[model samples]
Target: MVPEPEFRSYYGQPIIKGPLWHEPHMPAYLYLGGLSGASSLLAAGCELTGRDRLAAPAKIAAAAAGTAGAAFLVAELGRPERFLNMLRVFKTTSPMSVGSWILAAQSGLAAVAAGSALTGLLPSIGKAAGLATGITGPMMATYTAVLVADTAVPSWHTGHRELPFLFAGSALASAGAVAMVAAPHREAGPARRMAMVGAAMETVAGEVLERRLGLLAEPYREGSAGRLMRAARVLTVTGGALAAVSGLTRWRTPSVLSAAALTAGSLCVRFGVLRAGRASAADPKYTVVPQRERIDARERNRAHGR
Candidate 1:
């Protein structure tokens, strides 16, 4: 087995700088964006399948979430022009730019869909708008992962492959929570199943990531990030299990509580991811050790002439 890389630093000071995003703004943006994206897709699917009750509420929720998240994003940027400037150029290479475009389309389509539902005007147009959101919604939900993981932050960069799926699951769970709370039990049954599936996917993905990462995963196991992640896991699992039980027993109270837990857990997961990125960037070891190991392995490969 290869030896662990030793990382030296100045009195254990951080090598890389932490993210400058502030609380409630960045995390809230992430949560609401994901929730809106997933809800949009849910609305589209429900409408296509003749679940008008669930579809109507989901469209409204999607519009509200998207509009609120847009506000939070602008607040985080600290200026409206800063966000507006993002639309000046479309770059396929920049996740931020791509996300902006996606959000623009998502928010507009969601609004139109919601408005049509409310005003009973141009019903076919509303259905078309909802269908369009189904395309943009998943992109909005997952691109934030690319935005975060593309940074120099160690935890995020190292976990890039898993982050998108993690965010997708969180989005799905949040959407399910909204559906369960807003729709009738019969209409919400599919949402409960969605919540359970999303929870399982998120939990399993997290486990696989931490297990594969070994030492690099330390930031997720200690400090504030660790605490948030632990809470997310517990809440997500408990909520998912309760939702599953409710489906079997047809109980209303458990379903409601499960929705609340799942919503909270989804938010916690976003916060945990953000904190982990900060923690990883704050520690020099996270920046140095694994990279040094990769360099050492490459050098050894050259020496072997194979």
Candidate 2:
């Protein structure tokens, strides 16, 4: 067998720098932003379906998570003003710019809905605001995936096609879990169903990402990142199964357990994705191999044409 090509960078340094986002804060924000975004949509849907009991909890979850996620994002930036600066200009080419606007609108609408639901003030306005989130809510949930994928991080950039679905599914699971935990059991059937669906989507998309990426997927399937992904998979599958059971039997215990598992699993997915990106960026092999493969493929195509 031909000896494997050795990979190295200048002085063994990485070809590209990893993300500057700090741990806990960035991942926490990701989790919360997703929860808030998806919950807003769920709240609006519940209201339309006349499930006020379920809608109330969804509103509260959306509002609380949105505010908390904003705080975490600000923390990651080390200043709230830094976040506001991004809002000064919106650019179609910039995922961050678009995401900032989406976050602002989703958060504001969620807060208004929660406030109105809690205080019974401006009910009409609150209802309108809640409904409006459906336009921005999905963007809020999956825009982060775009933001990260736009970067040079190999793991994230390579998985762009699936990242949005992964994030969207995770967001749905998180929001649904909260509703399952907070809303009355009988009234939370939609939430349970949503959680199960989200879990299935996340799990399947993740598997596809790993399989399709081949060697590039090593970071996501090894070391701490691998451990976290495995844990997320277990929790998500178990939670989804439990959610289905709880939905049919109306078992409160199973409902609560399912909620806990789904939330934890969603958080794990965010953390694992970030870790995988970091690992891939810190190594030269991941970047070099992909470039070499593309070059080889192009050369082969040219030769064939000749």
Candidate 3:
């Protein structure tokens, strides 16, 4: 039997550099974008169901969150003006460019909807705008997963299939949390249900991601990333249970507590993912070893020519 090929990097260093994104910027952007995307969809649903009270606040929150996320993304680029430069090009292959366009559309429509709601003007136009976000909203929620997974990071790349589902679930949870907290008890039923379903999706997706990654998932099990992930699991489970019960009991305290926990858990998930990617990228073994094994397998296949 042929032995596994050995590999080494320059001076025993990582083969590829990790992302340069810093704290409170990239992660915050991710959280806010996800919140905005899902909230916009929820607002549209509430509007369709004639829950004006819920729709108004949800629309406003979606606009605010999307705008805030955009600002954070610009800050990460080192200058607010640099964001404008991205508009100069439209590249279908670039996730960043596609995301920028989607964000702009989602934020613009949400802001218009919220602004019209405030002035009690252009009711039909506002509804149209809210409906428009429904198209871009899901894309906004899930595209970030592709953006990150497209990178060279071991953890991120290997889990590409599951990341979109994970992010989508997290987005739903965040949106539901905001809606539950901000909307009145009478109108918060859908929000609670959404939170419960989202929590389940996130938990299941996370488990699948870890299991499929095998050794690549080590980053999520050790160090600060591990701590955050563990805390996220606890918080997600607790929040989901509370949300499930909150619907039946209709208790304000349980609803609020559940919302808070779910929101915090979503943030932890984003941060944990970022940290795990960094950890995976920083370790030379993750990059070198997997690639060497892949090369060996390819060579074996070619030699046999079966």
Candidate 4:
């Protein structure tokens, strides 16, 4: 066979640049963000349904996760003092900055809601905070899509539209899973329903993104990312079905198993998304060709207008 052409990096160094932060930092951030967002949603649902006992844990978890995740993000920035720089300006084009603000607001609201639950004081204020958190929680759950999409990574940027939905769904399932584990069956009904809804949304969004993202989608369907995402889909679907059916019959074992499955599936989605982004960034073709084509297309359009 003919010898394969040798590939050389600039200055004979590596072509792919790994992320600045360690894997633990990034992966933990993903898990924490999902957990926090889902917890807020669960808390809100519990409050609405008069399940105060369930709301207590959900609120506390949301607050803790939100605050801790924000701390990790600041730490990952490498210079703790420079964290304020993120809030110095508001630019719609900068997803990082916007997401930071969202996270900040979410964390604050969650803290208040949690504190109120713990103190058993200011019930009205707690309700208000819970409502506010419910609004911000969804944004926290899904804005990572916009954050990743804004990057130069091909797989992530291409899947931007669907990523938000995927994250939101995963967050919902994760929160539901936690509630199912902690609350009584009657109190956990809303959690099960939320999990089913989230799972369904995640599966649909992932399928659509995989089908519509063209070549960039390859990363999510061909290697480790593919394996994780496929597993996520299967587990989510199966678990969600069980959750839905559990409502019809009060089978504690099946309900518990389904909740566990949903939690695992949600974690897989986060890991798979991160892996797909890394894979997209590592491939030169993914980074260069699409951008070059876009530039060419823009130039052609300008010339035609002239």
Q: Estimate each model's TM-score.
A: 0.96, 0.98, 0.95, 0.85
lDDT by residue for model 3 (1-306), tens: 999766566787777899899998999999999999999989989888999999998899899999999999998999977888887788999998888888889989999999998898999999999989888888889889999999999999999999999999999998998899899987898888889988999999999998988889999889999998888888988999999888887579999999999999999999999999999999898987777778999999999994
Ranking of all candidate structures by their TM-score, best first: 2, 1, 3, 4
lDDT of 4 by residue, 171-229 (tens): 88888777776777766788788888888998999999999987788889978989999
Scored against the true structure, residue 298 in model 1 reaches a CA lDDT of 94
Error of 1 at 260 (Å): 0.8
lDDT of candidate 2 over 3-74, digit per residue (tens) = 986777788789898898889999999999999999988998998999999999999999999999999999
Q: After superposition, how far is residue 166 of candidate 3 from its true place, in Å?
A: 0.8
Scored by lDDT, model 1 comes in at 0.90
By lDDT rank, best first, the candidates go: 2, 3, 1, 4
Give lDDT tens digits, candidate 1, residues 1-306: 999666679998888889999887999999999999999989999988999989998999999999999999999999999999999999999999999999899999999999999999999999999999999999999999999999999999989888888888888888888888788887788788888888888888778778877777888888988998889899999999988887876668988888888989998988988988898999898888888789999999999995
Number of the predicted model whose TM-score against the real structure is largest: 2
Lowest lDDT block of 10, candidate 2: 4-13
lDDT (CA) per prediction? 0.90, 0.92, 0.91, 0.82
At residue 140, candidate 2 shows an lDDT of 90
Shift of residue 291 alpha carbon in model 1, Å: 1.4
Candidate 2: lDDT of 76?
94
- Model 1, total clashes: 0
